[model samples]
Target: MSSTCYLSLDWPTAPAWVNYNSLQQLSYFTTVFLAAPLALLTGLGMSPALSTRFRRISKLVSIQAARSLHFLVLVWFLVFLVVHVALVFTTDLQSNLNQMYAARGGDGWTGLWVFLASMAVVIGGWIAATPFTLRRLRALPHHEQITQHFCIQGWSGVTKWGGVSMRTILDLVKPRPEAKWVVFYSLGDGPDKWRYYDAHPIEQMSHRLTMLAYDMNGRPLSFGHGAPLRLRNEVQLGFKQVKWIEGIEFVADFSRIGGGHGGYNQDHEFFGYHQAL
Candidate 1:
C-alpha cells in the first residue's frame, strides 16, 4: 500500500510506499480496513444463506456470529466517526489548509492545547454533574423521615420518606442573595393549560425535615405515589408539597407569578398558597 499526505511542510518525492504514498495509504486504510470490511460483513449478514447449511461452519461463521459482526461493525464505525470529527473540528481544522495546519505555521499547538483544556472542563463537569446528581439523585446524603401528611380534605396519613436533604441541594445550587423563594413546578397541569407550580420560602427549603423524595416506605416511588421525584415538606399541607416535580426556579417573590398568587391551585381553586398542617 502506498499513500501521500501533507502532514509536514515538505512535498516529498513520489509520496509513495510500495507503489503508494501518504494519500494512497490513507485511501487503502479507509477502503480496505474500515469501509470495505464493514460493507463486506454487512452484505454477508444480510444474505439468507447464512442461516442454512452455512450455520455449521466451524462455529465461527454461524448466523448469530454473522449478525453480531454486522452489529459490531456499525458500532465501531460510529465511534470512529465521532472521534475523527472531534479531532478535526476541535484540533486541526483549517479553512485554508494550504497555508496552515503545519507545525511550522506557528499555531500548531494552540488548537490542541485549547481542545485539551476544553475536554478537561467538560469531563470535570460530567463527573461533577452525573455521579452526584443529574437523573441519578441517590448519591446525595440520604435523610429518612416518618411524618404525617395533612390534606385540606381532612384526610391524613403517616408515611416514611427516603430522600436527600434540601440543604444538600441548596449547597449545590448556591442561590443568589436576592433569591427568597424557590418554585417547584409539576408535570401536571390544570384545565385551561394552567401550569401547576408552587413557591416555598428558601429558609424552609434548607430545613432539616424538607426533602425531594424518590423512595417511599423503603421502596422506589410508584407512579401512583409520584414516581422519580416529589417534594416533602413535613410542616406544610399536602398541596404545598408538590408531586411529579419537573423543574425548579429561584426567585425573589411569587406575587408576580401565575394569577398574582403563589401557586397554581391557589390561583385556580382558591386554596391558601401558604398553609401549614
Candidate 2:
C-alpha cells in the first residue's frame, strides 16, 4: 500500500494475493483512521495536567474512561499487528522484509538479519532502563507529616500528609510586605507539560490547612501520586493542589506568568482562578 493510503479514509483495493473482503477493508480503515485518533485523544484526556485543567473536557471523557479507552486502543494495535504480520508473510514475506528492513526489493537474508538486530537493540534498551527509572523515583525528597482533609472532583478523604505548613515556609522566606499572591511551581517539562505553576491569594497561604506534602497516608507518596511534593489548599478545588512541587514564589500578581490567567489551568483551560467548587 502507498503511504498516501494511510492519510486518506479511502479504502485501497487489496492486492489479489491477499484476497481481503469488504469486512476486512472496513476493519483496516477503522483501525487506521478511527482507532488511532481515538487512542491519541483518550491518551491526552488521561493526563492529570490536562484533565485537571480542562474540567469540562474531563467531565465529557472522564479520566477513568480515558484510561479504559487507552487500554482498548493497545489491544486494537496488538490485534492489528498480528493481522498485519500474518498477511505480510502469507502474501510475500521476502518483499515485505526487504522494503521495511533493507529499504530495497530483494529476497536476501540481509533484511531478516537487520530486522533481528533491530529487535535486539529495542529489547536491550528496555532491559537497561529499569534500574535508572527506579533510582530517579527513589531520589525524591521527603518532609514532615500533617493530617488534613483532601478533596478532588466529587470525592473527599481525610489523610495524614507529611510536609511543612505553607505558613511556616513562608515565614522563613520573609516574603515582601506588599506581595499579595503566592505561586507554586512543579517539576514538568516539554510543550505538553502543564505550565507547572499556580497562584493563590497570599492570605490563603496562612490558613492552617495549607501545606506542601511529601507523604500521604503514613507513607512516602508514590511517584504516581505525586512523589516529591504536592500542595494542600483546603478551600479550593483539587486542581489548585499542585503536585510535584519544585518551588514557591511570592508575587503581587500572576498576570505576567504563563498566559496571565493566574495559573496554568486558568490559562490553558479557562478554569476559574479561584475554584472553591
Best-performing candidate as measured by lDDT: 2
Writing each residue's lDDT as its tens digit, candidate 1 over 162-223 gives 98888889998899999998888766555543456788888899788999999999999988
Candidate 2 runs further than 4 Å off: 1-152, 189-191, 275-277
Question: After best superposition, candidate 1 residue 268: deviation in angstroms?
Answer: 1.2
Task: List lDDT for all candidates, in order.
Answer: 0.67, 0.70
Clash number for model 1?
16
Once fitted onto the true fold, the runs of candidate 1 whose alpha carbons sit more than 4 angstroms away are: 1-117, 125-136
Q: Which candidate ranks first by TM-score, i.e. highest? A: 1
All candidates' TM-scores?
A: 0.57, 0.45
**How would you encode candidate 2's per-residue C-alpha lDDT over 1-277 as one tens digit per residue?**
4435444635443344346556567778989898999998998876645554575776677666787999999998998888777766655677768878998886887777888899999999988764323244234443444444555556656677776677776766689998998887666432444346788888888887787776788787788677777788877777778887655677787676666787777777884556453
Per-structure clash totals for the candidates: 16, 2
